[model samples]
Each structure stands twice: as C-alpha cells, then as structure tokens.
Target: MRKFTEEVKPSRAVFVKWPLGHPFGEPFKVRQHNAVIRKAFEALKTIKKPGTIIDLPFRWRRDEDWEDKN
Candidate 1:
C-alpha cells in the first residue's frame, strides 16, 4: 500500500474498505457506489494542502446486498 501511494504521489488518497473486485460497491448498486465516490471527492476538495490521507466515512455492508453470487 505504501509503495503504491509513493508511486502515485497524489495530493490526497481516499481508501475504501471494500473488497478487491468490488472497489465501488455491490454490483447493481450504482447509485450507492457513486454516492461514495462523490463523498470522497468532497473530502479531497476541502484539502488546502497536499499529503492528506482521508479515510472515507463509509463501509460496505456484508449482508445479502453484497453476497457473492458465484
């Protein structure tokens, strides 16, 4: 994680606690996923300086909504 962060060198980074294949949210829950993205962007926009790490205030539910169909 540190290596990737160093390589990118972004002004800020938002880390979501979702799984690998599901970076956004459950498959079909586009609205929910997009909402999360928008919130992250909002946090980034508020940063006046660089080198900020904003852990998003969101979490993916492990209920039936996010069940692995495979």
Candidate 2:
C-alpha cells in the first residue's frame, strides 16, 4: 500500500517492499522485526518534514541473514 500511503500523506511513514500483513518480515523472526523497528525509530527521529516516507533498505525474503549486514 505504498501508493495508498503516499495519497494519505501521513506525517511520517516507513515503506517496506514486503508482502501485505508481513510488514515486519516473516512471522517469528525476532531479529528481522527488530531491524525494521530500529529503522522506523530512526526515521521517526531523523525525518524533519511532515509527509516524509522513509523507504527502508531491507529486501523481502533475502537469502542471507536479515540482520547480519544491517
């Protein structure tokens, strides 16, 4: 719903290219979830303008470990 989010123009947002209902990564993956949350918090702190949507740098279902490099 990235396009939808764009239209809504929330004060701040984080966009992840993962499937719907799995925004925080696959179920039960704590590290992946934490990484996504961390980035969101960073956005929350760093975004200076309203309606800013931060496109996170995580790939959906990547082969390597999710939090290893990030």
Candidate 3:
C-alpha cells in the first residue's frame, strides 16, 4: 500500500523504499535485513519532532534485476 504514515503524523517513523512484500530485502539477505531493523530502532531513539519521517538509504534491486539464484 502507498505509505500512509503521513496521516498518522507519527512523532517518529522510518520509511523504506523496498518492494511491497519484501520490505527488508529478499529472503535470507541477513545484512540488508539487519540494516532495515537497525535504522528503524535508531530513528525511534533519535527523532524528536512530530511527523519526522526517515527514508532509509538502502535501495532494492529492480524486480527485473532480482535473481532467484537460490
């Protein structure tokens, strides 16, 4: 779904740009998963203002580019 965090106007939020179902990254990519979780908690600790939205720096590989080599 489209990001609706703006409506909540949360005092702190972390927005990731990953695809719909795979917010952290493809299954089993531990490092990417860790980063997503890590930044979120960090945002929770650091954001001080209402409606603070932190967009993660991680980028997802395009659907066409993602490989199911596993």
Candidate 4:
C-alpha cells in the first residue's frame, strides 16, 4: 500500500515492508509489535512534512532475534 499511500497523500505514515495483513508484525510477538508502535509514535513526533512516509527498518523474516536488539 505504499503506492496507495503515495497517491492518496495522507498527512503522515509509517511504512513497514511486512506481509499485507501483518502490519504490526506476527501475532503474539509483543516485542515486534511494540517496536512498530514505537516507530509510529516516533514518526508522529518527528515527521515534519505532509504525506511523509517513514520507511521502517524492520525486515519481514530476518535471522536475528528482534528481542535481543533495541
């Protein structure tokens, strides 16, 4: 939906390149969920331009454990 977001031009957005439905990461993975949320909040606080989409750094299925990192 990044293309849609670009076309629609929302006020602000946080773009995570995960699966279509799992916008906040896999179910029950609280750490991953919280990380996405925190990024969204961070975008909300720092995004200065309209229609700005901050592409999140998280990957869909990485090898490393997310809980071990910040």
Backbone clash numbers for all candidates listed: 0, 0, 0, 0
Worst 10 residues of 3 by lDDT: 61-70
Cα lDDT tens digits, model 3, 1-70, are 3258778787888887777888778898766667677777888878988789997656676433223222
Cα lDDT of model 1 by residue, 1-70, tens digit: 4456657878877666776677677787766677667766776678767866666545677444323321
Root-mean-square deviation of Cα positions for candidate 3 versus the true structure, in angstroms: 5.8
Cα lDDT tens digits for candidate 4, 1-70? 7898899898889988888998888888888888878878888879999889998778887625455544
lDDT of 2 by residue, 36-63 (tens): 8888888878999999999877888882
Q: Judged by lDDT against the true structure, how good is candidate 1? A: 0.64
User: Every model's Cα RMSD, please?
Assistant: 6.2, 1.8, 5.8, 2.0
Model 3: how far residue 25 lies from native, Å: 1.4
Candidate 1 ranges beyond 4 A from true positions: 1-3, 62-70
Best by lDDT: 2
- Choose 1 or 2, whichever is better by TM-score: 2
TM-score of each: 0.63, 0.86, 0.73, 0.85
In order, what lDDT does every prediction score? 0.64, 0.84, 0.70, 0.81
The regions of model 4 sitting more than 4 angstroms off are: 63-70
Candidate 1: clashing pairs of residues: none
